[model samples]
Structures are given as structure tokens and as C-alpha cells.
Target: MNDCVAWSGGRPVEWLLTNAPVDKHWCTIHATHMTAEEATALAASGAVVGLCPTTEANLGDGLFPFEDYAGAEGNWGVGTDSHVSVSPIAELRLLEYGQRIARQERNIAAGTQDRSTGRALLEHAWAGGSQASGRSTGGLEVGQRADILSLNENHPVLVGRTGDEILDSWIFSGENTPVQNVMVGGKWVIRDGHHEREEEILDNYATVLRRLST
Candidate 1:
């Protein structure tokens, strides 16, 4: 898991930090083999580890040592690296679940905040992903990009939830998402739970699958 030669040019995290010759972010993507020294060095380097728990589990990759890295105040973000599951909920849910299973303890990602695990996951992932990409995302601030996801607050799964509870429900709940609307770059792309080109996109996808099968 900590195959520095496989992932990088065998540059240790500390060397990369002081020499500034390579980006350490690529080396820690799945730091399963990383030592405590490497973890601390990468954490101090201000690089975000792009974690894709669902894909990692799907491919039987060794579980990441999330507790140790997080204990070092490492920055991380979630992703769907292999497109195994496109839903961010699935990614986040698995990320936490994997840690819980490995440690035999629940709420491993929440740290000291026992009740707000989901909230912490969402916020950190959002912020880390933004930082990694160096984009003006991850917030609703006026100058930020207008990428917004609106959940159906009236959905049965979230009916009585409030505040971070709503976020928790949307992420940890089942796959049937409550996202009824989406806006990207200040334009409405999906509304009332339907994309404008939903049928066309499906047809095109089906055509490609059919051709590949033939």
C-alpha cells in the first residue's frame, strides 16, 4: 500500500518537502504502507490525500490507516476514482464504514465529535477537494462558483431532520438520493429530479453499451 516507488520516484515525503522537487500529494493517495514519519511529513506538507474508499474496497485494496493520518491532522478528500459508485454518499459512507470495520469501532472519522460524524466528513471532504483542485468551490460565499445541490427537505428520509442532521441523513441514508435540484456555474442543470437531457443521455449510453456488446 505504501509503494513509494510505484506511486512516485521513490522520493520520501520529507525529501519532497525540503527539496520541493515533486508533489507529495500523489504519493499518499493510498498510504497503506506509509510510516508514521511519512504520514506526519505529508500532513505537514499541506497536501490533500484523495481517498476513494468505495473503489479501494471494490478492488480489495488494503484499508487505509485513516486514524493515524487523521491523528496527524492530515488533509484528505473523497473521490470515485474507479467510478465504482458515482454517488458521493456511497463514497463517504464507505469511507467511514471501512474505518469502523478495520478498527472495530463506530464513528471513526468523527474524532471527538461523536454526534456529527457525517457533518464532519462532508465538510472536510468538500474543503479538501476544493483545496486539492485549487478551485473557488466548497462554499456558498458570493465569490465562489455557483455549484449547488439542493436536497428534497420534504423527502420521507429527511422529513424531521434539521441542520447537520439533514446532511447526515442525505449521506448515510440509502442510495435513492433526495437531491431534487442541481445548479452548476449559476445554471440550473437538473430540477424537479429530472435532467433536461435525461432520456437522450440514457439512450446514448445504451447505444454505446449495445455497440460494445455486438
Candidate 2:
């Protein structure tokens, strides 16, 4: 982790001499706190800040410098580091809400092209998550990997909405409606929010927990 700080801290000075971009290929976890200079240098390196918002909130790690990071045009993505909360919506909501609380502004993520805050966050997660995973995906566009989430449009939260409102409701409204299904690599791993082998998986997990406790 010190290595990350060292590299982030030194990038600006180093960039002046080398004229080469610092890599985002292997950066994942970041030390929770970093100096302004370090954050600036790291952002200059084209690295995506790996943020697990739920975990960060639970651990009381200080918030990231969203405005500063935004000013630096830093890349960012989400993760489920501790397995405590795995829902994609929860992570994204926490991410935006955290920023709103820290920056004291509404729609703190507005950006060019992606004007809606929700859309921008989705785009960032889609692009940066794909990059972090070393997979080429995150959109429905042609030639991209087939990863998609299908929602229940008739759900209460989604009723009477179209386009960005739907997305905004999903991320900002604190709805508990689970993902109806998930397709990853053109295969369905979750159907109606229930895993394909959920019962068996839960049984096995319970067995392991029992053994660990005894």
C-alpha cells in the first residue's frame, strides 16, 4: 500500500522528466488516506481509484476527494471487497451519496456528454470496472462483452419513468428491488435475484460456518 502512495506521490515530478503515463493496469486497493499531492499525482497517472463504498462507510475510512479527484480527471470504479454487501445498486448509491455528503452539493458528478449524475456514475463504473477487471465490457454497444443487468420495469420504483429517471431511481432512491437477472458473458448466473444453485450454496456455506464455529 505504501508503494501506491509512493508512486502517487511521485508521479507529477516523475511525469515531468519521463513524459510517459503511469499505468492503471495493476492498481486496485488504495490506502484510505493520501496527501493532496499524492492524489493529484495518482490521478495524473491515469489510474482508476478502486472504491468499495459500502466497505469504506462501514470501516469509517475517510471519504475520497471527489471534487479534487474530479478536477484531476481521475478514473474510478467499484468493488465488493469484504463480501458484506454485494448488490451493485447499493455500492453505486453509497458511492454517490458519500460524495454528496462530502462535497455538500447536489449532482456532484455532472460531466460532459453524460449530463445526468446517475449516467455518469454508471459509465464510470462500467468503464473503470471493466478496465480494473481486465475485461472489455460495461455497455450494450457492439463488439463489447455481453454483460448486462435486466431490471423489472414494472416494479414500483421503476413505474412511470423513462431513460435517466429510471437509472436515477435505481441509484438514488434507496429502493430494495433486487436485480431480476444478470447476464455475464452471455450466460445467466442469476435469475429473479436467486442464484442458479442458491440453496446448495447456502447449505455449503452454513456447513462451513458451523465447522468454523465449533
Candidate 3:
């Protein structure tokens, strides 16, 4: 897929789908230039669309037709393609915001059944990411890796927030990283908003940047 946008009027999508083996050669249809019909066809083909909202905006790429894509039940996931913004919350927030501005409506990413735009966006990204990464984990479940993030309920953005509101606030209102703890495969990697190897990692990163600057 290699960040595919509507090159050749989307003939590349048709050509790839036709030539590639089923379930073996999935694509990341970076779909800013794709039309509704093209998105629908890509969805029906079961390909994963890699959406990098922040990067798209930075590059002046056209807004992704999120409403149309979701309406077709498309398989899509968010990515920090350019590493300009590394947070998942930023990606989700910008994605929804772009849709709202384009459609001139609030909560545009919310599903027909679920009104929580945050929850819907999270679930969609989780499901699509699972498929995209070929990982058995995205959400909590038996036989899946226990990857979890604990939010700081005491944080100002999350004060008094509950249920889906917690997710909404975290994505839309939270400043910096609101994650208090992160557990990957049942192992604690981040505690109290700091990675266990923060100092060492930063030291090494700085060294690398210095060397590169020379």
C-alpha cells in the first residue's frame, strides 16, 4: 500500500486488489484522495486503510471522507506516519475534528448505534489495527496479549468524568500524556506517567541526535 492516495484516479487500488492474493496482500489505502465509491470498494475488498490525520493536515492533503468510509463499514486505522504527532489521542482527536469541520457537525465520528464518538473511534481503530498488525491483541480478551493503559483519573481533564466520558475527555481535552501506567503483555513498562528507563533512554536519544547533527 505504501501510503496510497488517489493516484491514477484509484486505478491502482483496483489493479492491486485484482492482482494480489486474498488475505495475504493487504494494503494501507492512505485514502485522502479517494472518493466515496473508491472507499466503499476498498472497504468491501477488506483492505486496511492507514489514516494519518495529522500528517495529512501537515501536507495539505484533502480531508478523508470519514463519514462516508464509516458508513460503508470500512476497515481503517490511525497511524503517526510522519511522527509529527505520536499520540493515539492526537490522531483520534484530529481525525474527528477534521470530519466535524468538513461536515459542519459535531460528533460526526459517532456511530449510528453508539453516540460516543470517542468510543466508536477507539473501537474502530483497535479492530482495524489488530488486522493491520496481525496481532491478537487490541482489546482485552482471552488468548490475547494483555496490553492496557491506565488513565489518570485525578488529572484535571478527567476530573468527574465517567464511562465513555473518560475516553472523550482524554482524547479531546487532556493535555500531555494522561496515561498513568502502561502494561504491555502484563508487564509494567510505564508507571506514574514515566517510562521505567526514561533517563537512560533520553540520554541515548540525545547522544544520537548530537551525532546526527554533526
Candidate 4:
């Protein structure tokens, strides 16, 4: 906010939108200060607003205008900005929870009675994330990147849950990760709840941490 106010000369949303590229994203969930006109234009412009709820809460950045942004039919997605929380569940959960708290309402993400809250949030994030990345990885279909997340069907919390219920259980149920496998481009990167190169990755991360700390 301070930076936007200082740098944008009181027209932060317009300045940022004007300067941002059309083919990419306009990030940092700029709706907090956006007017109705700016919100509508941003929605129509088709730039995905990267809303990092966990990071925003961690830094006390302020509440995003969920009603305004979604009301304008905005394209939006979650992110792990500053690495506060890498779990997509955490991001989506907090996004909805934050809105619920702010608006004193429930199921704000679904935006309707018939829609499942978790399902709605997941679809919004999935499509917007793919679009913002400019990648052909949005859905499970031909001509799309084979990006997949397979949940542990045997996980206690997930046992017997089906369809959107599975997503609801995973995202809203507990902290323990239920993802058993992950595949990208038809290759397995995570299986049985472990990354293929976990040890090596941790070792390299420690080395980088030491170097950066020094």
C-alpha cells in the first residue's frame, strides 16, 4: 500500500494495469484499492490476479476485496508468495476463510447454493493458475499438459469420499497431506507421498540456505 501510494501518484490500480503485460498476469491481488470501474476493467482485461492468501495473512498485508473482484467476474488464482505456505490447500482454505471472516458470511467462494465450496475454489485456482502461467495445463483433456494430482484414496480422512467430496475432504478436513502421487507431463515426480529426489533436494536447499545466510 505504501509503495503503491508513493509510486502510483494516487492512481495505483490504473498505473499497474496500464504497465502490466496483456499476455501475462497482474499479480499481488490489487483489488483492495481498486474502484468498481477498475475492478470491472481488470476482470474484462483477463489478467489473472494472483491472490496469495497465506502470504497476505502472514505479512498482515490486508484483506483482498473478494466481493469486488469476484463480483466483477475476475480471473483469480492462488500463490505461495514469500513461501509462507506452499500447500495449495492452505492457500485455497485461507482464501475462503478470510472472505468468510471479513464478510461475516459462509461459503463465499462458491458464490451459490448448489455449488460445492471446495470444488468451486479448486476449479477457479486451477484454471487461473494455468492461464496466468501461460501454460497448456489447465484440465485433464487432450492437447493439455498431463499435470495431475492423485490423492491417497486410502487416507482415513479421504476414505469413501468421492468426486467433489474428495476435494472438500482434502482441502477442508485436516493438515496431513493426502496426496499420494503427482505427475507432470506424464512423468511421476512424487509417489507414495515422497518426492523422487527428496534427500538431494533437501541437501541442496541446506547448502543454499547456508550460502544465503552468510
Q: TM-score rank, highest first? A: 3, 4, 1, 2
Query: Over the stretch 1-214, how does candidate 4's per-residue lDDT look in tens digits?
Result: 5687787765666776678765345454535567777777778787788888888788787777778879988888887766647888998998898899988888898998777999999999988888877788868889899999888889998999888888888988868989999998889999999999999999999999999999
Overall local distance difference test of candidate 1: 0.79
Counting clashing residue pairs in each candidate, in order, gives 1, 0, 0, 0
lDDT of 4: 0.82
Off by over 4 Å in 1: 1-28
Off by over 4 Å in 3: 1-10, 22-25, 112-114
- Model 2, poorest ten-residue lDDT window? 10-19
RMSD of 4: 2.3
Q: What is the lDDT of residue 150 in candidate 2?
A: 88
Q: Name every residue pair that clashes in candidate 4.
A: none
Per-residue lDDT of model 1, residues 1-214, tens digit only: 2475567756455446666743434434655556677777778777888788877777787777787789998888877675648877898898888888878888777886557888889888988878777777889997898889899988988999998899888888889789999998899999999998999999999999999999
Please identify which of the two predictions, 3 or 4, would achieve the higher lDDT against the true structure.
4
Ten-residue stretch with the least lDDT total in model 1: 21-30
Candidate 2 on 89-120: residue-level lDDT in tens? 78888877888787676777775444787888
Error of 3 at 47 (Å): 1.6
Q: Which prediction has the highest TM-score against the true structure?
A: 3
**TM-score for all predictions?**
0.87, 0.83, 0.89, 0.89
The deviation in Å at residue 113 for candidate 3 is 9.4
